[model samples]
Target chain A: MFYREAGEFKTSYVDDNQTFPIRFDRYRYYFVLFAAFLVIPFAVNDYWVNAVFMPFLIYSIAAIGLNILVGYCGQVSLGTGGFMAVGAYACYKLMTAMPEVNIFFHVLMAGGITAMVGMAFGLPSLRIKGFYLAVATLAAQFFLVWLFNKVPWFYNYSASGQISAPERTVFGIAVTGANTSAWASYMFCLVFVFICGILARNLTRGTQGRKWMAIRDMDIAAEIIGVDPLKSKLSAFAVSSFFIGVSGALFFSVYLGAVEVGEAFGITKSFLVLFMVIIGGLGSIFGSFAGAAFLVLLPVLLKNVLVGMLGWPTDLAAHLEFMIVGAMIIIFLIAEPHGLAQLWRVAKEKLRLWPFPH
Target chain B: MSNEEGYVTADGRKIGGTLMEMKNITLRFGGVKAITDISFDIKEGEIRAIIGPNGAGKSSMLNVISGFYVPQEGEVWFKGAKRPQMRPYQVAQQGIARTFQNIALFEGMSVLDNVMTGRLNYMKSNILHQAMWKGKAEKEEVENREAVEKIIDFLEIQSIRKTPVARLPYGLKKRVELARALAAEPMLLLLDEPMAGMNVEEKEDMSRFILDVNDEFGTTIALIEHDMGVVMDLSDRVVVMDYGKKIGDGTPDEVRSNQDVIDAYLGVSHD
Candidate 1:
């Protein structure tokens, strides 16, 4: 009875129409923000922050980008890692080419560069859809990854064709390379992610997002109802790629520090982001973050607990992580096809009705 | 209405003018003809019905008119403008909207959202205002929602406004689909079997709504249906087609007794 959503007074239309009208929900959201921005950073050790939380957040952002294209727009892609590679390489190129440019703008411009490349791959989507569309994207993923590996210019003319990060500053504050502190990196990531999150939320709620959903739901019906499928679909790709590209840039600059194409961003990395989206919630935006965190942290936590603390073999811990993650993926899919986002929603719902059977 | 086919308006509302003109519409799939030289006109604020036996290209004609299919030979004119072969969206933008034979709603989205999707083109809210949830975009949203709510009220779907379209019953889903088409506020509406799978009560309810839609919104309606009784009561004029050819075109009473129309349906098997 105490947990019910009833009697939540919404005096004005503005109050009534807020995304989360329930008082408890709004409070809970603030609690999460506090924990993420204030409490957790203070409490968590540098090891956890550097090795797990930071990577997870970056990957979550990338997963959010992929979910927009694949889950929301109904266009499956296998080129997330290729876009990431573009972002990483672009970031590297920007830093070296323009010594006087700020690191923050460089990272963002890197995101924009990836966006252009992602759009190029996304162009094939106009002629094809479904499985064929996925295959078409595969061409971009493979070709881009190969280009970064083979082209010396992408690697800044290095002999090994691998670009390494040079320590850089944003407004005289350290952001890139080993000299940069974890707090600066984390704060930078947090701020950018928040902005991107807000932008994405707004985009999905408005007319452009509706057009994409219409195309996703039923293209023929969408067309008959006055939604231009071609332009709308392309816009979905553009917006989706823009976000994913930015996430990729952030994942490289802030998190990885130094990057190589084949090792850091590749086909395997694409699967990593896809798994995050699948495990989080297919179309749910928050689910992308949740899925990314779950996937990113599971292995690290397993390694630490099973190997570091328990003195078990690294391979055994690795195998166990795989087994557990695989099993959870199956369980999550069977139990709730909507993913961890749905699970989180269910938990919140149950919490809302605690101590009441009805 | 037209001088050639006199349309008597209900309640003396002069909501009449030819909105869509189809001339010599021929659709062919390989050697088999789906529609052969069928010409028809739909007048503004009038319910025009196309009735025929199975495979007589009634739905095919609707599809052609709505730009789902490009007729091999014909001219489609809308609002006194010559219609080129446009995509379905182009037709929709030209003040034409349509519902499908099979209900195609976004199962995941709420009824309100589904209907709001129909007004996507009209609601020109960009990303910036949406991000801030203020200014022009938010204003446009409220305006569009008001229009959608009116349609929702008109269709008596206020209770199920926030329910997912998939959770709705067959009859309600059909109505929600209609609400969505209405949300577009089109001058012409094409309905492919509006009351296809309804019970007697639902059919009557739907018929009343259809009539109200014509009188209230003054939308030009072209529907393909099989139910003879409803067609006779609802349509100002009925066009009869067989094997894609217009066998008879006149007031319902004239076409109901036409020997050629009767022979097309009863004369032979799948003729």
Candidate 2:
């Protein structure tokens, strides 16, 4: 009864096209945002922040980016790790080069740099598609990793070839480096995630998002109806990389504190983000968060239950984690191709049609 | 059929000058000739039709006109300017919109969203404005939405506006495709088999909508169809083709009386 839209007549186009048109949905969204922004930081400790919240928040951004390119634009990319590495290294370089600038600016500028690199890789997409495009992005992944590793310039000629985030503060509170508190880093990442989430949501619901979907659904017809493939595709790549880059910057600088390009931003990182998009739901913003949270929490929950509670071996828990993830991905693909989002939609539809079985 | 003759249709609309002209177009695919030395012009305010049997290259002619296939020898003239070699999107931007023969609606998108995509060329807000969705972007979006809603109402697709195109019936999907094409508000509309697979009732509804679109909006139309009755009743002029070559070009009655068209239709041995 509470979920009905019976009398909520939209008087204008702006009112009709809102991100959450339902009153219940809008309130729930605001409640979630409030809890994330206000309640979580005050109540949570380091363990909760490090093990669950930070990774979930950071990876959600990456998932949204990949979903835009892979799900909405229909460009399969396996080089997300490489692009993330670009972001990390770019953030590192910018932090070191511009010590006086704001750390937030450094994070955004890192995203911008990764966008250019991402677009460079996205050029092959116009000429290739499907599995071929995936391979092309894989090439980008390998090439980017190798370039970052072999080139000492990216690492500032360090002996270990690892780029580390120096102490950076926002509003005089350290948000990066080993000296920072967990809450400070959490708030920092949370703010960026909030902005990125809103921006991604709005972009996907608007004309730009429709253009990407049009190209994804039917390129030839999209072209005949006036969607420029080059512009639409490259814009997807650019915007997707921007978010991935920001997430990477946060992952390395704020979350990880230090990273070697090979081990941290490896090919497996790309697969992890791809799995998040696939298992969460393709072409949905909420699916990105759902998938990221599910993946992040599953590993932790497994470790806690299997290793901590049941006294199982750590190695066995890790192995079991892989098996569970693999099985879930296959099941999600075969059973409900739209992943968690479709399930959510079905549940909502049933709720709306309550007491009437049709 | 002189080029200068301005014929008035029964609805009292004057068929204006040439909207789109194709001269001596020749399209070849490797060793196969899809269209050879074909010429046709769509008047500014008339419904033109191309009728032929299977493999007559009617689709190929439309493709050539829409810039999907580049002809080896021909000039495409639109509104008095010689059209340059361009992409399909460029042609669309030049005020030419078309529906596909296979109903190429974006199956993943809602009917409303699919129609809204046709306004992409019209909505020019930059990325920043769109992402922020304030001022110019919001205003342009509302403006476009109003226009798209008008087209939806015109097509009588309001009930299924929120439904995905994939979930729609075949006839509704075709109507949705028409809605998408009409949303572009093009000067010249190309319909590739608008009634390819439909019942008689659906065909009648589609014909009425097409005629209404032409009469109300004054849009010039060029459609490729196989239904003889619907084609003859709807189109002001008919271009008859067989085996990649034009056999007759005139009003429906003239083409119907032509010996070559009758022979082509009756499967008479041309050799």
Candidate 3:
């Protein structure tokens, strides 16, 4: 009864085209934002911040990026890890080379650099698609990792071959490095996530989104109907990589603080982000967030319930986690390929028609 | 046809000089010739039909006009200019829009979004503006939506505007495709078998829409159709092709009376 939109009349096109057309949805979105920004920082401790909130916020950004490329644009990419490395390294280089600049600009700059690199790798997509495009992006992933590993300049000639974030601040509040308070860092990543989410949602609802969807649905028909494939595909790459890059920057500088190219941002990391997009839902922005949250919480939930409570071996829990996630992917692909986002949509749809089964 | 003044039809609709001319066009696919030295002109504000049996290259000629296939030998003149070799999108941006024989709607999108895609070239706001969803991008989007809504209303598909194209019936899908093309506000509209698999009522509806579009918007239409009666009733002029060659080009009566056109349609006994 509360979810119904029976009397909500949209007299104008702009009203009808809103991100949340329903009055209830708009309020719900606002409530969620208020909780994320105003309530959560005051409540959570370091363990909760680092373990659950940090990874969820950061991976949400990465999932949004990959979804734009694969879900919206229909260009399969297996190089999210490599592209994220570009962002992390670029942020590292920016942080070290310009010590006085704020950490916020550093993250934005890193994303810009990653976007350029992402566009370069995205060129092959015009000539190839599907599994072939995935393979091409995989090459990008390996090549980026190797470049970061082999190049001494990237790690600043450190003997350990690891890059660490130097302490940085915005408005005299420490947002990075060892001395940062839990709330401070969480707020920093939270702000980025909020901005990125709004930007992504806005972009997807407009003309740019339509062109990308057109290209995805049918390239030949899209071209014939006046969408330039090159522009649409490359822009998807640029925007997606930009988000992935920002997430990577935050991941390295704020979240991890110290990362080895091989260990932290590797092939597995790429697959993890792709899994979030797939299991969340394709072609839906809310799906990206849902997928990220689901995957991030799954491991933690499995570890606590299976190992901590049941007294199972840690390694067994890890293996079981793998099997469960694998089985989930298969089931989702077979039953609800659109993922949790679609499931959520169906639930909302049903709720709207409740009290009667029409 | 050469008169500079341009004459009005018996129905009081004005028809102008040729809008597009295909001169000696030849298209080949490595030992296979699809269209061979065929020539035709589509005049302004008239419904033109290209009719042929299966594999007679009617679709190939349409492809050539839409810039999908570059003819090896021909000059395409549009509005008195020798058209350059343009990508299909560039051709579309030059005010040419078309529907496919097989419904080529973006099945994943809603009817409104599919129709909105036709206005992509017209929606000129940059990525930044769109990302912000404020100022220019939002304004341009509203403006385009207004235009698209007009087309949707004109085609009487208001109820299914939010429905995904994949879920629509074949008849509605065809109508949606026409709505999309019309949303482009194209100077020249190309339709490939618009009434291909429609029932009698559907065909009648489609024919009325086509005639209404031509009369109201004054859109110049070029269509390839198989149903002879529908083609004769709808088109002002008909071009008959047989095995990669133009057999007849004239008014419906002129084409229907041609011996070669009759032989192509009724079959000839060669002894």
- Predicted candidate 2 versus true structure: per-residue lDDT over A42-109, tens digit per residue: 99999999999999999999999999999999999999999999999999999999999999999999
TM-scores for every predicted model: 0.95, 0.98, 0.98
Docking class of 1: medium
True contacts kept of 3: 0.86
By DockQ rank, best first, the candidates go 2, 3, 1
Error of 2 at A223 (Å): 0.3
Q: Which 10 consecutive residues of model 3 chain A have the lowest summed lDDT?
A: A325-334
- For model 3, the DockQ equals 0.89
- Residues B1-271 of candidate 1 have per-residue lDDT tens digits of 3564445664465645677889998999999999998888877777889998899998888888888889899899887789887988888888788888999888877898899988876887666676666677777887788888899999999999878788889999999999999999988888889999899999999999998998888888888888889998998878998878899998788887999998887785664
Residue lDDT tens for model 3, A299-357: 88888999989999999889998899788778877898879999998999888888786
Candidate 3 segments exceeding 4 Å error: B1-6
Candidate 2: lDDT over CA atoms? 0.93
Task: Give the Å error, residue A77, model 1.
Answer: 0.4
The better-scoring model by lDDT among 1 and 3 is 3
| Predicted model with the maximum lDDT | 3
B160 Cα displacement, candidate 3 (Å): 0.4
Clashing pairs for model 2 are none
Would you give me the overall lDDT of model 1? Answer: 0.82
